[model samples]
Structure formats: structure tokens, C-alpha cells
Target: MAKGGIKFKDSAAAYERLAADVAARRFAPVYLLMGEESYFIDALCDRLAATILDESQRAFGQITVYGRDTEAGQVINLCRQMPMSGDRQVVIVKEAQQMRGLDKLSLYTQQPSPTTVLVLCHKEKSADKRSAFYKGAAAHGAVLESVRPRDYEIAGWLAEHLRRQGLAADGKALSMLTDHLGTDLSKIANELRKLLVSLPEGTKRITDADIEANIGISKDFNNFELCKAVLARDMERSLRIAAHFARNPKDNPLLLTVMALFGQFRQLFLLNYLRWQSRHKGLPFPPDGELMRILRLNNPYALGELKQAAGEWPNRKVFAILGLLREYDAKSKGLNAGGMSDGELLRELLLKIFLL
Candidate 1:
């Protein structure tokens, strides 16, 4: 058991640490897991509860309390109490942002009991780093930091996770998964687990076909198909998928779809420009190969259609499309369009891309 403890500078780092801890069984005394991604924080808390704490001892000192429901002083009192029938006791506090008198808890954290493991789960965007509670936890206990995932890193994370689970997915499938799921690691992990379990053990590869069949998406309709259609300039198929996405907002969030599409386009555009460069004559387009070396990550599909698109359109047109994408990105968030339905927004963007 490695008890050196993992210090996550960001949310992705937090998940990686949690994954490692789950595998290694090195539980810490005070875990301050705070992040915007509720799923990761909640999952880590659940893992500790289910896998770490013993039942008889749980009754004596395994207390689960919410910040809104109890005061910080009360939690401190619970922590001060002795454990029963076990060498260690666990105390989990959810939504630590709502708890009152946390400043007092800060004072108590200076000398946290070795026998008690106090877990504070803070909600996303709510925990104040400047507050006494956060400072106290960092000063005295272990802190699991959480930072939002950048768009570029999400695809690689998905691929790496699949590899860890003894499963492989093609670049197309990986891209599609990230596109649909957004940058939520917890959700991505859950979906991948579902896919892994549905198949026989020791299954090594996952395809776009397998993903579509096992996941909630329809067999014939998905972001991958849509991207292919758009790249081929198949306006009819693009409209069909966009219309379906428009109808089912929950199944296909418009904002996420927009982000996914524009992200692909931006990457493609970058790849296309790289292809045009004599410096990259022997290099792959999209520069995925080069980027992987620079970023120290695995990504082989970087130079896909973007390089071709750059060659297909004049420099002016490519710049115009980029501008249009930026406008659409803002409009999807209701920034430019004060009042517009999701379907109408999708329809407008589709038309813009088609005409461009």
C-alpha cells in the first residue's frame, strides 16, 4: 500500500489519483476532494465508504453528514469521539460549503486525530480557497485538488482510460465518445465500464460500432456519423442527425454538440494548415504525432481531415468558417441570440456550415 498520498493539482489529476488509490488501497487520514465535477468527488467518497470502512466500526464512528444538515462544530465533536471495534474511523461530510462555523473546524484541523479519517467533499465552484476551512485542511491534512479539463486533453484521457481497463478504441470512436460525453471524466468512465462489462472479459478492442450498440445512442445516428457526413458535405444526412439531436435535448445537448463539432473543425483546420507547410512535408496533418511528443500523451489522429479541409478551401474561406464557428459557439450559449430555440439554433449553424 502506497500511503505517500496523491496530490491532484486539478480534477483530472484527482481522478487519476482516485483510480490509483482504488487499485492500491492506500487510504489517507483527511481527504479534502473539492472540484466542479460532482461525479468524481461523489464516486471517490462512495469508494472510501464501501471499500474502506468496516461495518461494526462504521456504526460507532462511520458518520455520514451533509454540510447543510449539520454544523461544522457538530462534525468536529464526532471526529473527537473514539473509534469502536476498529483501528480507524471514518467521517464523511458532503457539500461542505453549506456548513456554518467551519472557521472553528479549521482550528480543530490543526491537530486532527490519527485514528479518525475526516473527509470533506466540497461542491464545484462553491468552496472558497481563501476561507479558513480550506486553508486549515491544506495546512493540516491531504488536499485533492480539482481543475477543469481542457478541451484538447479530454480525448486522450478517454483513450488512456480505455487502455487501463484492457480495452482499445479507434481514434474515431474515441473522438465520438468525447464529443458526446463532453469533458466529464466520471461519466466517461461509467460509460466505458458499461461497455467493458457487456462484452466478454479480456476483450481488447472497442469500436465505434460496439460503442453505439452498447451505449444509449442509436445504432445509425451519432456524432461520428454526423462528422463523417459533414466532412463529405452530405447536407441531407447532417440535417437528419441535427434534427434528431434537436428533438432530444437530453440525449443530445446542443451546447455539447456544438462544442464537439467546432472542436473537431478547429483541430481539422489546424491540421490542414500544417499540411500546407513545407516544414511539415513529411509530418502528419493535425500534428497529432508531433503534439503527442510535445504533450507527452498518446494521440495519433490529430492530422485527420483538417489538413485536407485547409487545402480544399482558400485561406480566406477557412478564416471565415473559423469566424462563423466562434459566432455559433457564442449563439449556442444565448449570447448573441437573446431568444432562440435549440432546434432553430442547430438549423442555423447547419446552414452556415453547409453554405460555407
Candidate 2:
């Protein structure tokens, strides 16, 4: 789960199941869509709003409210009433996290009307589990926790997102998309929507060329190549890419570069450990598929770069490089840099890493 420090367990599977149910028009009495991942909350809430009411019914049957402007009693009162001109009523409460005295709404849970679909969208954090409303909502309907997917799980999540759009990304395209866009699902989805609008009709498979031309992330001078160059100890190529980044700071942020390098070194560090375990401890190496999953990789052949990089640096050196990454990550955030530019800081960090 990517909702770091949140106590709730990963809710990705529940999200999928609930989405399927909502798509099939399986309406629950009361839904508490609360979690750190607001993207999931918004997507599901929008789906419910779009699917639950017909165009003619929205004027009278579909009602929307915000937390700041209303109270729990008002919401409950709305839920208690019968639909104006339809059999079913859909009440969507957006940003319910800001609403005070939400627990007071629990009074209605005991006799929740079967004709009302009350959706409470509490996002960016989990709700108070001890609240009567939380317990009542869970017992009466659903408390969907929209947990964010971790770094390793994001690719799969993105793939599923694309699959739902009736599109797919080739392996290279997927890597480029994830690496360039990072794990912000809303941004990724927005980009995909825009890219789809720009592409020729009948285009289903997003290719590297499409990403490069449409998204403007270079297939050549991206952080992916820079990480590969650093891992392979190609100082010349690393410096060259760093220069390109220096020239185009908007396109190549140093912070993202640091993150990419950190991810690469993390994989290399783990690969080094596995290799040592196999050679010294007489443990069998993980199969290619298992190793791929560990690294969150799409291509089996990509293992060659990781294995080769592991051999190029010792464990201690990888640790030192990781330390460099952390230091630069901070420097990129203006922590202790004596006025060095982001590009300059990145260049210095790479040099220090390679020297390790």
C-alpha cells in the first residue's frame, strides 16, 4: 500500500471488487468512501453518480452536496426523504472529510432507506474508525478504503487502468510512461486522455514513439537511460545526459532523476543480495518470473542490466550510492546546497555516486 504510515491494510482488491459491483448497478445503502487515495475515491464516486441516475432523473433524483456547507443531520434528512420523481435517489456528498459531527449521521443507519444511495466521499485520509458513523456505515453498506498502490504495484495498476480504457501499453511504452509520469494516477490518466485525443483514430497500443512525440518525454535522454548509464558505470554517457537535463530543467527535474536512480540502485542492491545468497549460502536463485515481480519489471530480459549492474558494484558501494541518492534528494529540496542549481547538484551527485 502506498498510503505510508496509514494503519489500514491495502484496499486495492476491495476497490476493484467494489468498482465491479458498482458497474453492475449493485447499490449499497450507504457508502463511506474514505482513504488516503483520493483518486480512487473520486473515480468511484463519479462512476456512481454517472451510472446511478438517468439524465431525466438527475434534476430531481441525483443530489450533490459538499461537507463545508452542510451538516450530518441535513444529509440524513435528505436521505430519509423519498425521491422526487424517481424510484431511487442518489445523494453524493463530496469532501465529507471536512464535515463536523458526521458521527451523528449514524442515527439513520439503523433504518437506512432501501431507495436511497448515500455516498460519503471522505478523502486524503482515513476516517475515525471509532466513530459511530464509521461503524454504522460499514455495517449498513460499505466503507471502501481507497489505498494507493505501492511503487511495485503501480505498473500493474496503470496497466489495469489502460485495460479499462480499451487500450494497452507495450512494455517499453509502459516503462516510459511510469518512469516519466511517476505514480500520480490522476496525472497519468489526464495525460493518457490528452494523448488519446491527439493520436490517430484506431490507435490502441501506446508505443514509445507515441509517448515521445505526444508527451514530450524523450525516448533517449530520459531518466531511464540515465539510470542505466549510471548502473553500467558509463560516466561519459551519464555526464552527457546530465548536460541535457541541465539544458532542459523543466523537462528533466533533478528530484525525479534522483528518485529514478534510487529505484535502480534499490533493485541492484537486492539483486546483489540474491546473487550472494545463491553463490555463498548455496540457495537457489529465484526464477526469472519471481525476480521480475520483485523488481516490478515488465521484461525478463531487463534482468540482464540488473544482474550486470550488481556485478559492477559491491554491496557496500551500492549502499554508499544509496546514501548519495538520499543526500542529493535533500539537496534538490534546497537542504544544505550552497546555492548550486538542480542540474549542478545532479551532476555532482552522479560524480560522487560513480566514484563510490
The most accurate candidate by TM-score is: 2
TM-score of 1: 0.82
Per-candidate TM equals 0.82, 0.94
lDDT of 1: 0.71
* Model 1 residue 22 CA deviation in Å: 5.9
Clashing pairs in 1: 10-147, 11-147, 268-306, 271-286, 272-306, 272-307, 285-303, 286-303
For each candidate, the alpha-carbon lDDT, in order, equals 0.71, 0.83
Model 1, 209-230: lDDT tens per residue?
7777788666456676776677
Give the clashing pairs for model 2: none
Model 1: how far residue 135 lies from native, Å: 3.7
RMSD of every candidate to native, in Å, equals 4.8, 2.2
The TM-score of candidate 2 is: 0.94
What's model 2's overall lDDT? 0.83
lDDT of 1 at 26: 79
